[model samples]
Structure formats: C-alpha cells, structure tokens
Target: MAIFVHLTSAANAARIRRAGLRADSWARTGERGVYCFPVLPSFTVTHQWLRELARRGTRGGGMVAVHLRLDDDEPVLVGHYAGRGKHAARSATAAEAVHRIRELDDPRGWEVFVPRAVTAGEVRRVRAVPQGVGWRYFPGAHGTRPCTCFGCRVRGEYGGRRLRERLPHPLDGPDPKVPVLLERLAAAGEPGDPKEVAEVLYWFARRRRGPVEALIRLTEHPDARIREDLVWAVGGWRSPGVGELLERLAGDPVAEVREAAAQARSDG
Candidate 1:
C-alpha cells in the first residue's frame, strides 16, 4: 500500500532495497521482494531518472522493475531487468551509449502498448496528439498479426519507422530493413499526406544505411515531399563527399527535414 514516489535519493534506494526488493525483477527474489516504481503518463520516464543516477556514479545494483501508469495512481504495465551504468561510461563512448540506450529504451517501459503496424482504421492513432496519447500507450508493438489501421495500411506503413523497429520478434539488434525499407519509404506509397510519408522517410534518413552521394542526387526529386525525404535520407548514409549537401539540408525550410539534418551531424 505504501509506494515510493521519489527514488531521487540514495536514502530512497536504500529504503526500497531494505524492503526486500529484488534487483532486476518485479516480484520478490528469494525473500528479497522487488519494489515496483510507477510513473504515470510515461512509464519509461524512470529510465531518465535511473540513467541520470548512473551518469552521476550511482549504479543500481538491485534490479528495479518499472511499472507504467496513466496517472500516478492508475496502473498500466510492468517490466523487469534494467541495468546500472557500467563504471566506464563516457560521452565519447558510442558502444556504451548504445547499450545504455537499448536498456533505457525498453519498449515495455510503458503501460499502454501501441503497435507500429498502422492499419487503415488506425490512422488516428499516429496523428500528432499532444504527446500524451502516445505516452499513455507505452510501447507500441504490432504482434505478428497484420495491422488493420487506416493510416498504417494507407501506404503499407504500419506507423512510424519505430513500429517496425519495436515489433515483438528480434528487436534487440539494429533494424534489419534499414537498407531496403529506406529505399521503399523513399518511394513510399503515395495518395496520403505527403507529411506522413516524409515522416517515415525522415526516419529512414535518421537510421542506418549505406552511401550518400548517389542518394543526395535523388534529393533533386521534383516533389517537395520527395525532396524533403531525400534531404534527410542523405544523412542516414555514410558516403563521403556529401557533407556540403548535408549541410544544406540542415537548413531546409521544412522543420522535420531540418531536424533530421541536425541529427546527422551527430551521426558521424
């Protein structure tokens, strides 16, 4: 009945640990029960706090099971096994950051689950709601079944590139479709909001891929959407000789396109 709202202090961690909390599980482990911490609106928000703790030299030796909720009181989802930061994490360490991100980015971190597969009927699901709708549905995963949402099925896109990334199977590694899907999303199904296509395309541009010089040439496509798509698309590739083109896209008029270019700068 007594829930610990603030694990912001070592005192709290120690107190929780004393209450038979298990490290890495929601339930008790060998009489060491796991203490559950819930964050409404965003269950994953705990990662931010926990990650900060790790950054500040506090490693969570005890496994903390994160429980997501709609409000501070309403329960949603519960998942287990988050890690404390390794003692050797650094800004320059890419692999460390990747591991940290992977652990923190646990899709199960949230209560409400959304599938990335946007069927024709689920268009509204992907619409730009005020962050809450998406947050309420913690990890949006599309099971093995096909999505029947309108927007998702509109152009054969489930939702954002994330849907494909978060599906239930084989998600621990980099998205396998990064290369081929980038090409297809470049030519994403037409007849919908060019903005949506641009969204998915921009996602491709942000993720992994190969070559940029050739793709930069495609940025010349007449359609503004395609142009916007290619502008960001270039950054996802690692080809040399296209830094200037990337620089130019960095200031593109479109907000998302410009955003993608800014992200590309850090990609290198």
Candidate 2:
C-alpha cells in the first residue's frame, strides 16, 4: 500500500469518515479527481499544500489531514502543480506516484490525482494539522515580485485590493497618466522598444479611452509581447474596430498572445 494525505476542511471530516472522499475536483487537465500528497518522511513537505489550499477559501472548520492507504496498483496521475493543459499529468500507479515524488530533490509543488473516489475503508485517519505549515499563493513566491494581475491577486481576496494599489500590475493598474501615455504611444513607431510598448498598452488598458487609432496601428507590431499586451488593453476599450482587432489576434502565431486575446474577448 502507498500512504497519501488529502488536506481538506475540518467541516467535511465527519462526512469523509462516513462516506469517503469523492473525486469532486477538476485537475489541470479538466479531469475530475481527488488530489493528495504522498506521506513523505518530512512532515512539513507532506503537508505543504495546507496554507495554499486554505488561501483558496476551502472553508468550513479548521483544516485536517486525511490519511489514505491505496493499493500499489491503483491508477493515478502525478505532476508539478504549475503545469497546464492536458499533457501536464503523467499516468502512474499509486505506488509509482509516491516513489517518483520521493526521488525529487524538492516536491513542494507536486500533487497526486486519484481519478476515482476513495472508499471509507481506504481512509486510515483524519487528524488536525498546523494551518501555517505550507506556502501561500505559490511555492518560492515569498521573495519574488508578485503579479498583481486580476488572475493572480483577484478581487475579493483579503488584502488583495490594497496590494494591487501599492504594487499595481503593468496590465492591471492604479490608473495611468493620459499625456505621458499618449506621448509613448506616439513614439512607439520610432524605436519600438518592447517594454515601452507594453507600458503604453498597460496604460491604455487602465485608461480605457485614448488615441485608440494610434493603438490600433500597433496590432501588427513585430514583438509578440506587445501584441499580447495590446490584446489585453483592448478589452477595456469601447472604440471602433476593437472587436476585429481581437479576432485577428485570436489567431496569433504566439500561443501566449492567442491565449491573451481569447481571455480579453471573454472578459470583454
């Protein structure tokens, strides 16, 4: 058997004890699964997801660690939590997943995905765990400059609004100066510095109104990063031809630019 721990709300403890764990959550690949971490020798590492999960608002009572015993041959998927799309998860048996994680030098952001529900018989015990044992937002995010984008800080999270105000994202901001922004946009054709273009688009995204005609001209900018920023900026614009511009960007050669265009259209 392989030992794994599923961290969840204490409020669900009674039900989990009675009925077992349901595969109620969607994995990165959009597959439904029950996520858990292997029971490593290091207590902190085994429970490292606690703080991040709590920050995601898994509310009820306090948090608890539900230990589970799975047969070595039970099917599962395992991968780094940061991977996206369908290919991120690797197929493995329950035992293989545990062994792979154990071999890693650092398994802080790794997770196991059990595709089927866990029966009550497989649950070993539910115990209280220290709430502050893990990383918040993401692993190694402590010293790095945080991305205050709407997708990152979001709107309603505690202290999110204040943080956005203090250290605004280039694309999501504390507003921008119209004159300075226009000057930069006008000069975009001169040297076409990608950073300057991104900054101009950021201001345009926040301002939502300006010399949109000049902004439209940059749609063909050679730099994909600028084009991505342009797609994001146009989301807030009420100007003419914005929809057409987005449609063109939706097929951008760069995947990130295309994704941004899709998101901008969806948000708009």
Candidate 3:
C-alpha cells in the first residue's frame, strides 16, 4: 500500500488517531468539508507546511506539528494544496517514502513523532510559545530577547503566558461529563458563535464515543441556527448515522439549515 503523511498539531493528531480526518468549518474553499492532504511526499513540503502554520499560528497557542501515517486505502477525502507535488509517485513503499522525505530537506520545525499512546521518555514534555512568540525567546536563540511588536506587547500586557507545555498523548476515551456537555450544547443559544459549537463538537467527536448521538439529538433543537451548526459539525464526522441525519436535515424548513445539510452530504 502507498504511504501518506499528514502534518497537524499534536492535539489534532490525537483527534485524527481517534476518529480520522474531518474538515471543519474553519477549512478553506476547496477544503470546506471532510478533507486532508493525503500525501506528504517529501520532508521539504512537510517543513514548508509546518512553517506556514507557525507563521499563521492559532488562537490557542504555539503548536507542536505531528506527522501521521495513513495508508492509500484509508477512507478520506484526498484534497490537494500548494505543498503537494503533482508528479510524485503515489505508490512508494513506507521505507522508500521515508527515505525520500529525509533526502528532500534538512529537518527544521518541531517535527518529531512519539508513536506512543501517552507521554514518556523524550515525549514527557514539549515546549511551545504563544501566537507571536517564537524560538527567539526560547533558551537557545543566540541571546535574542522578545520582539517589541504591538501584537506581542498586547499579548504580554494581558498577563498571557508565553511558553506552552504539550503532553504527547493519544485521544482519551469516553467520559461521563460528555453527555452533560452535550445537554448544555443542545440548550445553547441560537445567536452566539456557531464556530464555538462546531469546535466543541469537533473535540467531542475526537474523545467521546457518542458525540454523534448528541449531535443527532441536537438536530431537533428549537432554533434553526442551532440545527444549522449541528449539521455543519456533523459534516466533520464519519459515521453511518450521519448520512441518515443529513438526509433528514436536507428537508429542513430553514433554507440555511437545508443548504448546510446539502453541502455536508455533498462533501461526503
């Protein structure tokens, strides 16, 4: 089988391990739904993508980029981006692929694999910086100090912590509070940020066994906006019941909700 590597944050890597790739609303134009770059043909491309991520950091903090192995036959949407090579051989064996990746570039980013279920050894602790902060502020940066940029100053003025500590971990299994969280999710107001709901659902889909169930139940929520958010969140999940739910939601009274469900179904 052909080998493919997906580069993502360590937390998202944990999510991928549990439930596979799911394209959430934050995804861009060609990647609006369930999508992933099915190949990382070379380390040069991998480093490029990681540097891009570091350049455009997330709201949470600095992130540890992870490389995950996926086989060609794995069920996923094979999306393309600038980093993917059009002419690269897709039939390369795992060892051959790894060799190609290593030969392509000298490693730079925080690109390491723990390959274990939890923290231990060199995986016990990982260093991370905030959105604007970088290796320059870390201990080994040739004695450079923090940047004097406005973004950095604002971040620090608010008592923001710079270094982030990441635990190397796989997704944790079901918890009792998941159901309660689902209930609160179902009862959430319609006018607030749907992205927040989508984010919560993404995490729940990663760690909980029955988030799909909660989501399915939320489809019956009183507000059309809530229903729309649920449908958008469901697009990220790979499940048997999801197709059925989308089918039902396709006929929803609200045009927006119906359109969201139609797009979600079409994405799969």
Candidate 4:
C-alpha cells in the first residue's frame, strides 16, 4: 500500500470519518476526483497544500489531514495543479505517481487525482495539522510581482480589490490617461474600429476629468455600441453638458444604448 494524505476543513472531519472522501469536481476542467499528496519523506513537502486549501475553505474552519492507504497498482491521474485540464493529467498507478513525484527536485505544485470516491476502509486516520504550514497564494509567489488581471485577482476575494488598486495593470488600472484617451477618441471617427472606440470610452468612464466636448461629438456616431459606451463614460464626468448627453442617450433609438444610459444615470 502507498500512503497519501488529503487535506480538508476540520468542520467536515466527522462526516469524512464516517463516509470517507467523496470525488468532487473543483478544477476548471470539471474532472471529479479526490485530490491528495503522496506521503513523501520530507514532512513539509508531504503537507504542502494545507495553507492554500484552508484559504479557499470556510472562513473560520481549521484544517485536518486525512491519511489513506491505497493498493500500489490502484489507478490514478497525476500532474502539476497548474497544468490541470481535460487532457493534461497523466494516467498512472498509485505507486507510480508517488515514485514520479519523489524523483522531482521540487514537487510543490504536484497532485494526484483519484477519480473514484475513497471508502472508509481505505482511510487510516484524520489528524489536525498546523494551519499555517504551507504556501499561501501559490508556491514561489512570494517576492514576485502579482498579476492584477481579472482572472488572476477576481472580485470579492480577500484583499483582491485592494491589491488591484495598489498594483494596477496599465490597461485596466483605475487612472486613465486623458491625452491618450482623447487621441484615441479623435482617431475613432466614422470608419474607426468599434472595439478600439469602446475601449477608449471605458477608460473615459474611469476618469474624473477629460475633454467632454470630444466625447459629445461621438454621441452622433453611427455605431450604437460607441454611443452606448459614450453614455457610460459621460456618467463619470462632472463637466458641463454630461447630464444632457445622458438624457439624449436615454432616448436613443437602440434599446441597448437607452438601457446603458439609464443604468449609467442611475449609477451616477
């Protein structure tokens, strides 16, 4: 038998003790499985996922490590957590997966996926582990510049909003460059790229000051998308004529433009 450990919330310890661990789909690929780490020689390496898993677990719940004993030839899938996908995990026996990971110089992100549920008989014990033992955001993520993109730092995550504000991405940052935005607006004429025009308008919506006259000219642009974007952008401005522009857009022929105008007006 090969020893492995699955870390989960301490709150679920009683249910897990009674019923074992159920296979669940938590990956983007939607593969349902129990994630575990091989019981390697290094104590810290064996329980590396504790901190990250706890961060994603219930806000106040502590964590426990459940040990399992599986047959050496039991089927499993293994790979780095970062490469988890529909086809990225490699098929292997339980023992083979442990052997491959042991050979690695650093197996911080490695994981094993048992496609089926684990039986109560397979569980050896569930013990409390130090909640603060493992890495936080990711392995080796410390001292490195973090990505502030929506995908990297999603809304509502702990400290995500503040982190994005502190280290904002150039394009998606809160502060907008007025001169470049005006240039983009000026060049986005009748034959301009609708996507580019919309992007410029998005930046305008983040700004407190800009050329209101330049934006007013685009209110008559043929593309309803540009007009809709213009409505949203003008909603952020305190300059003269912004209210009138929103009122005009609220009566626009396109339903989407009119809706955007109404929503922006409500938001302002």
User: Per-residue lDDT of 1-268 in model 4, one digit per residue for the tens?
Assistant: 9999999878778877899987753433555568999999888999999877765544326888999999999998888887647325798999999999999888998899888889999999999877777777689987898888644553345787688878888756444578877677667666467888888877676555667777787778788988987886777677888888888888989987886787667545
Q: Candidate 3, 100: how far from true, in Å?
A: 37
List model 2 lDDT by residue over 149-207, tens digit each. 85676334678768877887786545557777877766766547888888777667654
Which parts of model 3 have CA positions greater than 4 angstroms off? 1-177, 183-209
Off by over 4 Å in 2: 84-87, 173-268
- What digit string (tens of lDDT, one per residue) describes model 3 on residues 1-268? 4333333455554445455544343232223332112235443444344434444333334454333444333333222222246422243334444444455433323222212222122122232323332233322434654443323322222322242112212332333366676665656655434655665665454331344654676676666877887776567566668888888899999988987887778546
**65: Cα error in model 2, Å:** 1.0
Model 3 residue 224 CA deviation in Å: 0.9
lDDT, candidate 1, 109-206, per-residue tens: 32121111112221111111111222211233334453333222222222534555455234234433656654554565434345655665655554
Which candidate tops TM-score? 2
Displacement of residue 170 (Cα, Å) in model 4 is 3.7
RMSD of each: 19.0, 9.3, 14.3, 11.8
Ranking by lDDT: 2, 4, 3, 1
Q: State the displacement of the C-alpha of residue 32, model 4, in Å, after optimal TM-score superposition.
A: 1.8
**Clash counts for the predictions, in order:** 26, 0, 0, 0
TM-score of each prediction: 0.29, 0.62, 0.32, 0.59
- The lDDT leader among the candidates is 2
Model 4 TM-score, 2 decimals: 0.59
Which residue pairs come into collision in candidate 4? none
Cα lDDT for residue 178, model 2? 76
Clashes of 1: 26
Give the 10-residue window scoring lowest on summed lDDT in candidate 4: 24-33
